[model samples]
Target: MRITRGLADIVIDSLCRGVFAGDCRRLSLRSCFPFLYDAECSKRSVVLGMVAGGDKTPHPDSPLIQRSKKEKWSQWSLRGGMQTLSEALESYIKDKGVEIHKDTPVEALERRADGRWQIKLPDGSVTADHMISAVPAAEMSRLLTPIAKPMASTLREMSASTVAVVNLEYDGEVLPVSGFGHLIPSFEDRAMLGIVYDSLAFPEHNRRSSSSTRLTVMLGGAWFESSVGDPDAVSKETLLSLASEAAATQLGVKEKPRRAIVTLNKSCIPQYTLGHWKRIDHLFSYIHQHSLPLSLIGASYQGVSVNDCIYNAKKAVQRLTGS
Candidate 1:
């Protein structure tokens, strides 16, 4: 927090607001806090795509919390899809005799007279000694409000942003330049936030013998309010039109995409704005004071990456089992 308030603030205050002066200063701040300053100069949506965290999210509380010089900068992509990571974990957990109920929406969470927790689903209720909620904060608040009004009210104040992902497949190679892809700064005023060069990043993405290209365009975060109409109501064609136009102009793609898929993630990533630490501190303090056998984890608290979720889950299990 001191580094962000002292060093980062000093560097940012010297620069003009919402202006891209040079790569050196911007990169320097990014080196310290990747998503914070960029969103300040541009749109929050741009960096929201990079880190699951939002624009005003406190830099000190961000994924960059680990500032060790020994930290490495290596990233790996799954051959199938990011979902494979969860699938693999599920398989391993199932083998360990964990019973997982899929597609069951939790309707309510109530403390029973016997001192157990009742998890009410549409079909029935299951009582447990402890519960770990991985759902979004909003959903968690909704489930817990009946039992914990004050805590639920505070959790509701935590806001989340929605993002729409448009996956486009061209008949042949369409990217003008090579590499992973490009992220547009909000100041640039592009409809699309960024483009991930899927085929370029991983050739196996194309799969077919044909040298086709796959581009994933991310749209609608904080920009959704200004750019796209309500994401849920926005038509697939409308999203594609905006994304394709940006691609053609920026990437020099003349051919229309052979395939276009749209995925609207609603209330997906939580925004960790200024003073976020206080809210988190209060949330945990209440849980401890109440002796609530409930542990909340996932993108809402720590981070939004697959690894982040797994790390938090492991810590929660250790806390609950006392192992």
Candidate 2:
């Protein structure tokens, strides 16, 4: 929820592909307009609505779609995407009734001979009968003495990736395309990964009613790997190219966006693979052997969805306190 470097790594890894192997548990948040995962009241679907016959757009594979359909997910409804880490946390906090002390990152943990754990912070330390940190696996591993950090190290070794969100706003209509715009398959050698017609996808924004529109572009995987440190510049160039492509190829409006804002999310998503659970289970087993009072939770392990984070946190807490 804090959107630490590690959490971002988790999300980017999940979304950008190749961070993990096997089929991804893809959820359709593809909508003509995306609603925050918690914005169920807005009556939005979660699937990208592409203009038929506009482009060689890539979508969730037929297998996945069939699965969704068989599960009774309606075809008429749209899906939601473009959710940020902050938005996901807000929804989780609202549901769980938890209060977050912003900027209060845990600094250190001391395990007592009798077993309790004490975590130090810049403000003050909190002693807990038991503690397991949910920090970035790398930092979490590094903080511990060599012997104790191995499990965390294993978690760190699990690969991850990042994503940069580019929100381009124009005062006038630009692209000819409607629906959800387009998604580039991995086979495409282009640097830009996916383009979402934000104005067309989600109709909730005040500006959506006007010719002015917002286009959200996601450039990542190979494109993001080079710009990991300075994602802003990379995202800017990527946005321009995408805008140009849309104007010339899709929209026919070539004028640049009146305003361009880029949000660089370093290591934004998690990459989960076949053996991921084995490593986590091994870590848990080792933790149990030590009987250290600690809990680890989040999208980095177990589940990447916001619901998974909250659900697993509660379950972990219940196990810890016998609640």
| Per-candidate alpha-carbon RMSD to the true structure | 8.6, 12.2
lDDT of 2 by residue, 211-314 (tens): 67778766664445543335544545654565456444545556767777766666656655446656777778988897655678866676565545657787
Please name the candidate that would achieve the greatest TM-score relative to the true structure. 1
Candidate 2 differs from the real structure by a C-alpha RMSD in angstroms, to one decimal, of 12.2
lDDT of 1 by residue, 1-323 (tens): 12355433444432311122112222234322445555544544544444654455432233553633246534456788788978998999999998888899998888998768999888898889988888988898899888998889888877766677889998877677998777665556424567888888877667576788899887766567577887657888888888898888888887988888988877666666555566778888999999998898988876656666777788798777788
lDDT of 2 at 238: 56
Q: Estimate TM-scores for all models.
A: 0.77, 0.63
Q: Which stretches of candidate 1 lie over 4 Å from their true place?
A: 1-73
Error of 1 at 319 (Å): 2.1
The whole-model C-alpha lDDT of candidate 2 against the native structure comes to 0.57
Supply every candidate's count of residue pairs whose N, Cα or C atoms clash at under 3 angstroms. Answer: 1, 40
